[model samples]
Target: AQSVAQPEDQVNVAEGNPLTVKCTYSVSGNPYLFWYVQYPNRGLQFLLKYITGDNLVKGSYGFEAEFNKSQTSFHLKKPSALVSDSALYFCAVRDNVGSARQLTFGSGTQLTVLP
Candidate 1:
Protein backbone atom coordinates (compact mmCIF):
# COMPACT_ATOMS: atom_id res chain seq x y z
CA ALA A 1 0.00 0.00 0.00
CA GLN A 2 1.14 3.59 -0.72
CA SER A 3 0.95 6.20 1.99
CA VAL A 4 2.25 9.52 3.35
CA ALA A 5 2.98 10.55 6.91
CA GLN A 6 3.50 14.02 8.34
CA PRO A 7 5.20 13.40 11.65
CA GLU A 8 4.61 16.84 13.13
CA ASP A 9 1.26 18.02 14.29
CA GLN A 10 2.36 21.64 14.35
CA VAL A 11 5.43 23.70 13.76
CA ASN A 12 6.03 27.06 15.43
CA VAL A 13 8.45 29.26 13.59
CA ALA A 14 9.58 32.83 14.07
CA GLU A 15 9.41 35.32 11.27
CA GLY A 16 12.65 35.65 9.28
CA ASN A 17 13.83 32.24 10.46
CA PRO A 18 14.11 29.10 8.42
CA LEU A 19 11.21 26.67 8.38
CA THR A 20 10.67 23.07 7.51
CA VAL A 21 7.62 20.81 7.41
CA LYS A 22 8.49 17.15 7.33
CA CYS A 23 6.92 14.58 5.01
CA THR A 24 7.57 10.94 4.19
CA TYR A 25 5.95 8.77 1.56
CA SER A 26 5.70 5.18 0.46
CA VAL A 27 4.74 3.98 -2.99
CA SER A 28 4.78 0.84 -5.11
CA GLY A 29 5.75 2.59 -8.34
CA ASN A 30 7.03 5.97 -9.49
CA PRO A 31 5.59 8.64 -7.24
CA TYR A 32 3.99 11.92 -8.27
CA LEU A 33 4.41 14.17 -5.26
CA PHE A 34 2.80 17.47 -4.30
CA TRP A 35 2.74 20.01 -1.51
CA TYR A 36 -0.30 22.13 -0.90
CA VAL A 37 -1.06 24.79 1.69
CA GLN A 38 -4.44 25.73 3.06
CA TYR A 39 -5.38 28.81 4.95
CA PRO A 40 -8.21 28.91 7.43
CA ASN A 41 -11.56 28.54 5.67
CA ARG A 42 -9.90 28.46 2.25
CA GLY A 43 -9.00 25.93 -0.40
CA LEU A 44 -5.64 24.30 -0.72
CA GLN A 45 -3.11 26.21 -2.82
CA PHE A 46 -0.43 24.43 -4.78
CA LEU A 47 2.97 25.22 -3.31
CA LEU A 48 5.20 22.88 -5.22
CA LYS A 49 5.41 19.47 -6.87
CA TYR A 50 7.92 16.82 -7.92
CA ILE A 51 6.84 15.01 -11.05
CA THR A 52 9.74 13.66 -13.14
CA GLY A 53 12.40 16.33 -13.01
CA ASP A 54 15.18 17.48 -10.75
CA ASN A 55 15.27 16.48 -7.12
CA LEU A 56 15.44 20.12 -6.19
CA VAL A 57 12.17 21.64 -7.39
CA LYS A 58 10.98 25.15 -6.65
CA GLY A 59 7.49 26.54 -6.76
CA SER A 60 5.21 29.28 -5.54
CA TYR A 61 5.94 31.58 -2.58
CA GLY A 62 9.67 31.00 -2.37
CA PHE A 63 9.18 27.38 -1.31
CA GLU A 64 11.19 24.41 -2.47
CA ALA A 65 11.44 20.64 -1.99
CA GLU A 66 13.92 17.88 -2.61
CA PHE A 67 12.97 14.36 -3.63
CA ASN A 68 14.92 11.62 -1.94
CA LYS A 69 14.47 8.29 -3.70
CA SER A 70 16.29 6.17 -1.13
CA GLN A 71 14.62 7.80 1.85
CA THR A 72 11.26 7.85 0.11
CA SER A 73 10.65 11.39 1.20
CA PHE A 74 10.00 14.90 -0.11
CA HIS A 75 10.30 17.58 2.54
CA LEU A 76 9.17 21.20 2.13
CA LYS A 77 11.51 24.00 3.14
CA LYS A 78 11.77 27.77 3.18
CA PRO A 79 14.76 29.98 3.87
CA SER A 80 12.77 32.54 5.82
CA ALA A 81 9.40 32.42 7.47
CA LEU A 82 6.66 35.00 7.33
CA VAL A 83 3.58 35.58 9.44
CA SER A 84 1.49 35.24 6.31
CA ASP A 85 3.00 31.84 5.72
CA SER A 86 1.27 30.43 8.74
CA ALA A 87 -1.30 27.93 7.59
CA LEU A 88 -2.11 24.26 7.27
CA TYR A 89 0.17 22.19 5.07
CA PHE A 90 -0.42 18.82 3.46
CA CYS A 91 1.77 16.35 1.61
CA ALA A 92 0.11 14.11 -0.93
CA VAL A 93 1.04 11.36 -3.34
CA ARG A 94 -0.51 9.46 -6.25
CA ASP A 95 0.66 6.24 -7.79
CA ASN A 96 -0.38 3.69 -10.39
CA VAL A 97 -3.17 2.24 -8.27
CA GLY A 98 -6.73 2.24 -9.53
CA SER A 99 -8.19 3.95 -6.47
CA ALA A 100 -5.45 6.53 -6.02
CA ARG A 101 -6.74 9.37 -8.15
CA GLN A 102 -7.64 11.62 -5.21
CA LEU A 103 -5.00 12.78 -2.83
CA THR A 104 -4.68 10.95 0.46
CA PHE A 105 -3.69 13.72 2.90
CA GLY A 106 -1.75 13.57 6.11
CA SER A 107 -3.29 14.62 9.40
CA GLY A 108 -1.98 18.11 8.55
CA THR A 109 0.63 20.35 10.12
CA GLN A 110 -0.45 23.67 11.52
CA LEU A 111 2.29 26.21 11.03
CA THR A 112 2.40 29.21 13.31
CA VAL A 113 4.69 32.12 12.67
CA LEU A 114 5.55 34.63 15.38
CA PRO A 115 6.57 38.14 14.56
Candidate 2:
Protein backbone atom coordinates (compact mmCIF):
# COMPACT_ATOMS: atom_id res chain seq x y z
CA ALA A 1 0.00 0.00 0.00
CA GLN A 2 1.33 3.39 -1.12
CA SER A 3 0.29 6.64 0.53
CA VAL A 4 1.32 10.23 1.19
CA ALA A 5 1.90 11.88 4.53
CA GLN A 6 1.65 15.63 5.08
CA PRO A 7 2.83 16.25 8.60
CA GLU A 8 1.46 19.75 8.75
CA ASP A 9 -2.15 20.67 8.25
CA GLN A 10 -1.31 24.33 7.89
CA VAL A 11 1.74 26.46 7.24
CA ASN A 12 1.90 30.20 7.81
CA VAL A 13 4.51 32.56 6.41
CA ALA A 14 5.10 36.20 5.72
CA GLU A 15 4.83 37.55 2.25
CA GLY A 16 8.12 37.76 0.33
CA ASN A 17 9.75 35.16 2.52
CA PRO A 18 10.56 31.70 1.37
CA LEU A 19 8.14 28.89 2.13
CA THR A 20 7.98 25.15 2.12
CA VAL A 21 5.30 22.48 2.52
CA LYS A 22 6.62 19.07 3.37
CA CYS A 23 5.47 15.76 1.92
CA THR A 24 6.56 12.15 2.10
CA TYR A 25 5.30 9.08 0.31
CA SER A 26 5.58 5.33 0.04
CA VAL A 27 5.19 3.46 -3.21
CA SER A 28 5.83 -0.02 -4.50
CA GLY A 29 7.05 0.57 -8.05
CA ASN A 30 8.91 3.52 -9.55
CA PRO A 31 7.35 6.63 -8.02
CA TYR A 32 5.84 9.44 -10.00
CA LEU A 33 5.69 12.58 -7.88
CA PHE A 34 3.38 15.51 -8.43
CA TRP A 35 2.48 18.86 -6.84
CA TYR A 36 -0.77 20.71 -7.19
CA VAL A 37 -2.37 23.92 -5.93
CA GLN A 38 -6.01 24.69 -5.24
CA TYR A 39 -7.80 27.97 -4.67
CA PRO A 40 -11.04 28.00 -2.70
CA ASN A 41 -13.46 25.59 -4.32
CA ARG A 42 -11.46 25.60 -7.52
CA GLY A 43 -9.92 22.71 -9.35
CA LEU A 44 -6.38 21.64 -8.74
CA GLN A 45 -3.68 23.02 -10.98
CA PHE A 46 -0.72 20.86 -11.91
CA LEU A 47 2.46 22.34 -10.55
CA LEU A 48 5.10 19.79 -11.43
CA LYS A 49 6.18 16.16 -11.56
CA TYR A 50 9.23 13.94 -11.24
CA ILE A 51 8.81 10.75 -13.22
CA THR A 52 12.48 10.01 -13.45
CA GLY A 53 15.96 11.43 -14.13
CA ASP A 54 16.49 14.63 -12.14
CA ASN A 55 16.53 14.98 -8.38
CA LEU A 56 15.68 18.67 -8.27
CA VAL A 57 12.60 19.44 -10.35
CA LYS A 58 11.34 22.94 -11.10
CA GLY A 59 7.69 23.66 -11.49
CA SER A 60 5.11 26.33 -12.21
CA TYR A 61 4.63 29.55 -10.18
CA GLY A 62 8.21 29.60 -8.99
CA PHE A 63 7.72 26.30 -7.19
CA GLU A 64 10.03 23.31 -7.05
CA ALA A 65 10.57 20.03 -5.22
CA GLU A 66 13.44 17.72 -4.46
CA PHE A 67 13.01 14.01 -4.92
CA ASN A 68 15.00 12.04 -2.39
CA LYS A 69 15.22 8.37 -3.06
CA SER A 70 16.85 7.38 0.18
CA GLN A 71 14.52 9.27 2.47
CA THR A 72 11.55 8.59 0.24
CA SER A 73 10.51 12.20 0.52
CA PHE A 74 9.46 14.99 -1.80
CA HIS A 75 9.19 18.42 -0.27
CA LEU A 76 7.79 21.37 -2.20
CA LYS A 77 9.61 24.67 -2.00
CA LYS A 78 9.30 28.23 -3.19
CA PRO A 79 12.06 30.79 -2.98
CA SER A 80 9.64 33.64 -2.43
CA ALA A 81 6.13 33.46 -1.11
CA LEU A 82 3.39 35.71 -2.37
CA VAL A 83 0.14 36.67 -0.74
CA SER A 84 -1.57 35.31 -3.79
CA ASP A 85 0.21 32.07 -3.20
CA SER A 86 -1.92 31.53 -0.14
CA ALA A 87 -3.93 28.51 -1.00
CA LEU A 88 -4.25 24.78 -0.51
CA TYR A 89 -1.15 22.89 -1.56
CA PHE A 90 -1.18 19.20 -2.19
CA CYS A 91 1.52 16.62 -2.84
CA ALA A 92 0.59 13.53 -4.79
CA VAL A 93 2.02 10.22 -5.80
CA ARG A 94 1.14 8.21 -8.90
CA ASP A 95 2.21 4.62 -8.64
CA ASN A 96 0.91 1.20 -9.57
CA VAL A 97 0.61 -0.42 -6.18
CA GLY A 98 -2.34 -2.74 -6.71
CA SER A 99 -5.45 -1.23 -8.26
CA ALA A 100 -5.77 1.37 -11.01
CA ARG A 101 -3.35 4.30 -11.35
CA GLN A 102 -4.54 7.10 -9.10
CA LEU A 103 -3.15 10.15 -7.35
CA THR A 104 -3.06 9.87 -3.60
CA PHE A 105 -3.40 13.33 -2.07
CA GLY A 106 -1.66 14.54 1.06
CA SER A 107 -4.82 15.80 2.81
CA GLY A 108 -3.77 19.32 1.78
CA THR A 109 -1.56 21.84 3.48
CA GLN A 110 -3.04 25.26 3.87
CA LEU A 111 -0.55 28.04 3.23
CA THR A 112 -1.49 31.31 4.85
CA VAL A 113 0.39 34.43 3.80
CA LEU A 114 0.56 37.33 6.20
CA PRO A 115 1.20 40.61 4.51
TM-scores of all candidate predictions against the true structure: 0.94, 0.94
Off by over 4 Å in 2: 96-99
How close is each model in CA RMSD to the real structure?
Answer: 1.2, 1.2
List, residue by residue over 1-114, the lDDT tens digit for candidate 2.
678999999999999999989999998887899999999989999999999998999999999999999999999999999999999999999885567577888999999989
Worst 10 residues of 2 by lDDT: 94-103
Model 1 quality (TM-score) = 0.94
Residue 83 alpha-carbon offset, candidate 1, angstroms: 0.6
lDDT by residue for model 1 (1-38), tens: 67899999999999999999999998888888899999
Instruction: Please report how far candidate 1 places residue 62 from its true position, in Å.
Output: 0.5
